[model samples]
Target: MKSFLTILFFVAITAFSTDTVQSQTFPKMDTSPMDLAMARPDRNTPPIARVIYSRPQKNGREIFGELVPYGKVWRTGANEATELTIYEPLKVNETVLQPGTYTLYTIPEEDMWTVIINKNANVWGTVYKKENDIVRLETPARNAAAPAESLSMVFRPENNGATLMIGWDKTYVEVPFEKVK
Candidate 1:
């Protein structure tokens, strides 16, 4: 029965090796991945504003007013706090924000959304303090004709500035800002 014992030993060793390898390997599923979007004034010019955030997929789930909830401060994105960098000073809804990096947070509501730019940056999750907020502007929330499966932020260049558009599911909000002279 030496051959039988040898076969059993080989199977045991193989199973143990497989278990060890699997345990040491990273997880195959990545729930949320980091994403970057930027806005440039001109084709040849450098980006005036940049946003870094993690895109969370819908996954056939109800996003707004449910998963994200309403009237609560959201991190604005997944993983690390959503970050925004401005290369130049800009006026966001008549409030002048200096050229620097800031963390973006939002309070989503059924009718309106409050966009907050805080001094805190590179934070984890929805840990926000009102004392750190630089500006809080309420913007209109519009309904999208089609649903968005993934969260997205876009900058639409206007006459002398750009509008930051944040969209998810079937809702979106736009924050218009002007470049200060």
Candidate 2:
């Protein structure tokens, strides 16, 4: 009878542990589709940065107008949203940014675009309030070198830091913020 009880206890422990492990390893429900609503979706590769998201990129064909439409707040990628993150102090245009992470926001238009550096983080894309935003600046549209068939936010390598370039259609705009000492 003692041996029988010991066997039962072991079986119960193993089952409970297995259940716990399975729950922990269960696949996380995809939130990238909901994350990149405002930004144009990249067809080839999802535009959302991978490191920023805990899950695999939310990517699919026909995501732009069909899934993610124009003229909205984009999380910048999969996960909570694309955080306008910064580690060191940064200077956008004339404004000074202290050490902090911020939500990068944008207001798109036909001729030009309004890109903003908000103080708010941990927001679901633009779902949170915009009042916490520190600075909102507009960048003039730049002519694309060639027609880009994708919605891409490319950070071109620079000798110092790099230029953050946002491109869609034929019009593009750039914000060059150098790393501060």
Q: lDDT tens digits, residues 108-127, model 2?
A: 65556777777777776457
State model 2's lDDT.
0.58
Q: Which residue pairs clash in candidate 1?
A: none
TM-score of 1: 0.84
Q: For model 1, how does the per-residue alpha-carbon lDDT over 1-181 read when each residue is reduced to its tens digit? A: 9999999999999999999998998877668888888888879988888889999999999898899999999998899999999988889877888889999999999889999999998899988999998989999999988888889999998888889999999999998878898
CA-lDDT, candidates in order: 0.91, 0.58
Task: Judge candidate 1 at residue 157 and give its lDDT.
Answer: 88
Which portions of model 1 show Cα errors greater than 4 Å? 1-29
Off by over 4 Å in 2: 1-79, 143-150, 169-171
